[model samples]
Target: MSLPSVLLRLVASLAFATLASSLSHAQSGEPGCRPEMAGHRLPIQRVQLAKDEVRLTFVGHATFLIETPGGVKIATDYNDYVRPPVTPDIATMNKAHSTHNSRRPDPAIKQVLPGWDPAGKGAAHHDVTLGDVRVRNVPTNIRSYEGGTDYDGNSIFVFEIGDLCIAHLGHLHHPLEPGHLRALGRVDIVLFPVDGSYTLDQEGMLEVLKSLQARVMIPMHFFGGGTLNRFLARTQELWPVERREQPTITLSKAALPTKPTMIVLPGH
Candidate 1:
């Protein structure tokens, strides 16, 4: 039977979407998935679309600078602790702690996405596409001042660019639930908070890692070597920890590691 042109187009689009989804999962080495470019390491160089690479620099604490191949610069968990050398095109903030957000950000930033809603909304729903990078958030609860839990107080911002899904867990106060994992999608790289006291404890953080199961995990928000070592010791059994001397790293889908790895970058 011959189908109408409109219906044919719709079918084609749906098929393409399904294929893309399958390919994304395959790249992560999940159950029964086979991907073409799963274990290749990209060249270490500046940001360039020719390489399909994005540069991530750890500024300090929960903040990271993400530079895309399409010339879009994004700052994750931007605050006053340490600012990016240059003003970023987009800044994602979470107000769980003072270091996770800044009341007054540089007005020059093109887009400022705050995790919490000042108007008392339950969650901050964001799905903004800028240049070649798409920014979105999965809201999570945070520890409140009065020893209770605050709803939708933090966001786990995810950036999708050039076939890579990068997520930054900002002030993650508790272990993620099933819904949180569903919203996070399949993350290729994750910038995680490793401060046992400030954020999640070692046991709690391990639980979060089990749920996300990202290939590359970048440790952030750690205060000292002692604290960082404690987290490293915990991951020795299941996760391999690598210390990166340089603060910046360029990543591409083809350069992902086969096993889940914990990467440490020096910063405040």
Candidate 2:
């Protein structure tokens, strides 16, 4: 009712808004710190990739070589087994086991982001940009060999390129917490591990898949045929399955499936 009272109220409101905005920025960190990075959206006719497209190559044992349109190459779970011959622009590794994490990565690689610290004190945090691709990680706890617990032992690496988000669940041993999901945001393609004993069990892995709601789901890290076959049988009735003879699959924003689909790459 009073002029002075209205002015004072407006000032207070603006101050509160500023504080809220500051907090949000702090939580997300700088531009590269947050994985839920947003950019301009381009609409194209039909479900075809006009220009922005990414190629995902299964390099065995949870490792995937993600090649971006801008010539940025990223390798996930860069252990000794079946790494790409050429040096990658970025490499993301986990500490769940010896096979999932690398002890000695090539020094020539531009960026090597390990999921956990070797000292085993705190979680791993990474947000980096290589060329047109942006890479970030969300850490999760792992079960120790001595029947104990190791905090931040694994990382779900998220790659954002060409307006598409791809996630590699690097030896994820447990279900994702709310914070992890919030950090991951929306995943277009997910490289998931289906080994029941090693990673999340088949049923639990399915639950994680459902939670993520990714368009392209590729199974990896299975030990043998038995485990992989069982996983396929379990999900066939629900999600669609596509077995590709080749190891790599290229996808784009427009090519993402309407419903969740399981894509099995030949190299395991």
Model 1, 120-224: lDDT tens per residue? 868999999999999999999888889898899889999999789999989888999989998899999988888887678988998888888899999888888
* RMSD vs true structure, all candidates: 19.0, 19.9
Q: What do the candidate models score in CA lDDT, each in turn? A: 0.84, 0.82
Candidate 1: list runs displaced more than 4 Å: 1-51
The most accurate candidate by TM-score is 1
- Report model 2's TM-score to 2 decimal places: 0.79
- The TM-scores of all predictions, comma-separated, are 0.81, 0.79
Candidate 2 lDDT (Cα, 0 to 1): 0.82
Pairs with backbone N, CA or C atoms under 3 Å apart (clashes), candidate 2: none
Q: What is candidate 2's lDDT per residue for 108-167, written digit by digit as tens?
A: 889999998766668888999888888999988888888787778888899999789999
Clashes of 1: 0
- Residue 82 in model 1: lDDT: 63
Candidate 1 TM-score to native = 0.81
